[model samples]
Target: MIGAMWKGMSGIYQQDRGIAVESNNLANSSTVGHKKDQITFADLLYTNGGMGHGVGSQSVSKQFQQGQIVGTGVGIDVALEGKGFMVVRSRENPDEIFYTRAGNLVQAKDGFLVNQDDYKMQGLVPQSRLTSSTNPADTMFTDEFARNIVSTNISNSLGRIFNINAKTTDYASSAKNDDIAQKGDNYKSSQSKINDVDALREDYINKLKEYQLTPNVPEISSQAQKSQVDFSSKISSLTSEDNKLSITVGNKTFSVEFDHDGNINQDEMEKLYNFLDDSGREKYGLIDPSSIPTQDDIDNMPITTPEEIQAKADRQSLRDNSINAYSSAKSLVKAMQDLSDKISAYAGYSSSAKSGTLEIEGLIQGKEFKISEVELNNEKINSTNIQEAIKGSGMAMIDSAKEALKQAVEKADAKYLEITNVLDYADLNTIGMTDLNVRLDVLGLADKDVADVEISDDGFIFVKSGDNKFLVGRLSTASFRNEQGLNPAGGNLYSQTDLSGNPFNADTMNTIKGKSLERANVDYGTTLTQIMVYQKAFEANSKSITTSDEFLQTAIGLIK
Candidate 1:
């Protein structure tokens, strides 16, 4: 009877242990990364031929099966897929390392990457400083180039004006020479008129001598008639010579027909002189007759006076200025070209390429990632569209250049706008990513602090600092050879024991970020059925004990 009671007590103890295991699994059903425990029972040593002593509570093992993966758009909420645990260390105790399947991460005030329990994640040390090679200084530099171009253009025009002014001075000097030649012609005509008058006086004196010597009216009258006949002949000859003097000068010819009896007919001479003078002046570009000096004033006149000379000199200076301007323009253009190259370098653009495509490369967690085209969301950008924006005059060109620069920057923005870290098997080229601080603070030139953090399925950690993003680190995952032998530590963590094999790196294929944790493997319905069975088994054991006790009591009563 005592042995039956002892057996009943052992059954109750084992059942209680089973109930405890089921209750624990049920209690942690909502816990993240929680694994359910299963209780195993073994029969005690056999005492009789067909009877066993009692039940023994065997080992309690955990079911390491995967739960359904759910997506939570949050960047920091990380979850494991098939088999792995994130390695983390307690901030309070830096040397203590714990393995967890939960991936909810955040940046502590001290800038350490931590999980929900303030456990620091274990991974490669993050790069301290990073320089984003995006073109933020392009606008300022382009404006400078435009200003130089404007100055160059002005100088080039000045050079052209200077050449025109030199030609103008030559024309003015020619007019002056024409005026002097006209004056010389008038002086020669006056000398010829004086000589003709002298000749006439000599002829009169000779005729007087002839008349005095004869002292006869008849002789004088005959002589005077002869002289008059000769004079008329001379007059005819002079008029014919004067008509021949009228000749074609430039494009037109004119005739100055003198009177038959002439003492050098002033009207005919004046007409001839005027026609030639006007033609000469017209040929020299002296179209303003009023501005031209007459034959009488030509000796003292000049085509360009001292003031006009100074004006020509001033024009020459302007020409020189224009030349200087042209030279400056050349220099400015060369400088702008150099500056353009520098700007391209600053913004990670290659001017050497004939095509508009520029390679945009950035570092994420110290790994270099490159994107061939400037694009976002699969949209390719046209360089023509960007260049089209840079049109117009000097200042307008500056604005245009700025617009072009902005478009170039947009290319960088598009290439790395979102925090993408998952390695896509479909497209290998689309594997680049950027974090909040890396894009906003570093590349975007923002100054805001970190506001959030995110981890991808591939274990890439991104920190959001004040609307900016930075690739802080990559989360390292570990896999144990004997996961079943892992000792459960409190707070959804597991510790490696001698029985559990040392943790090794987990394959990335099984890891997924932005997913819900694995649900507990416990089935409440099964646990309830087992509990009922245990209750019946305990009742049967107790009944055996009670029947044994009653039989003993009846035997004692019969002996009395």
Candidate 2:
């Protein structure tokens, strides 16, 4: 009976331990990178018979099964996809190393990649920096080369592994110091030339604007009127024997003859005006003559004089006419005005009759024009009678400046392209170096602002600074022969033991998933079920102890 009680007490103790283990697993169901603990029971001290001692908790081991991977969209967060652990070292003690699946990382103020505990992540750098060469046979540092170099350098221990640093510096000194210095000088010279050309181009543009605004208006005018003459007397004098007037505009010519009674041929006059209007329209592409606003249109009525009817012959013919045949001075003035208007229209010039003077001006601001020929009554008018043409100095200067500006712009663009290619080549040569400051110095961007830092799926660390991105280093991972034999250290970390051989570089199949994390592998439902079973077994053992006590009490009572 006493032995039975002892047996029940042992069962109760083991069942209590089993409950504790299941409870622990349930509590850590949401812990990141947590593994569930499993407990096993065994009988102790087997006797000669088949019956054995009460059951006791034998061993507790961690189940190293894969966890569910979930995306967190964080740039620094990473997760292992297969069988491997990210290697990290103690910040205070460099010799102490640990492996973990928790990849929530942060950048320290000192420019090192660290976890929340400030443990620095291990990384590998290239063995040697690539050389900048123009030769086709030269080996270039490509993405594939970067991966291969990192894999080759990985080791079981942190033998030569280093913490990745993101600090930048200017002008990294190297063995080929003279070559780098010469390149730097060339870059500065090209940049200076660009600045000078830019200033010159701006000056030229301003000058062009000034020239366009202030044009050289070339104008020619006939002499002012001397005195007025009587209308009827002048007409009679001019029409003594049916005088004929011939005018030429551009390539077309027309003639008008007056009758013996001082009346003009209306049909002939109409033909002359029509030719001038049509020729003007065809040459200058001017709008329809009827659409042009006249002085009468501005005044909203017909302006008339006492001898206007006699001078113009009819209102329809005088609608757009500026002529007044009241005197020889008027007649001559009107004739000049008519000739100027026709020539101006056909040759893209502006004409006006004001203050008894007829003038013709060039349409373009800084351009010049001349009347090719002018004749009246079969006598050619002397060139001296017309004003001399004005030269377009401003326009000539603008054209010359435009050509020079275009050439300067082209040269500046080509120089910029060349500088860009050189910088790119320099970046490629220095990217894989082990030292972060050296990489920045060699690329001449130590003072540039860092934009972002990202870890790729293949574990490459990229630092974007200014307009360029540099490959700083690669993250390192390790794998053990027997992962279940690893000792569980606090904070989701594991330490290698004799049972678990020394960690080696993770196989190629194990990759990193950036911006994601692995959830704990503890199953809530299975843990809850195990807890219930342990609770029932504990109650049964307690009942057994009580029943054994009752039997002892019955036996003792019967003996009394």
What's each prediction's clash count? 22, 3
Tens digits of lDDT, candidate 2, 203-322: 444544554455453322211112111112223345444454344433555344443332323343332234333432232232333443444545554348757544444544443342
Instruction: Highest lDDT: give the candidate number.
Output: 2
Cα-based lDDT at residue 11, candidate 2: 92
- Give lDDT for model 2: 0.52
Give the residue spans of candidate 1 off by over 4 A. 48-50, 105-107, 125-447, 465-468, 555-560
lDDT of 1 by residue, 139-233 (tens): 11111121111000011211110000000011111211112223212111222222322332233233333333432232111100000000111
Q: What TM-score, over all chains together, does every model reach?
A: 0.46, 0.47
Question: lDDT of each model, Cα atoms only?
Answer: 0.43, 0.52
Residue clash pairs of candidate 2 = 169-446, 172-441, 216-365
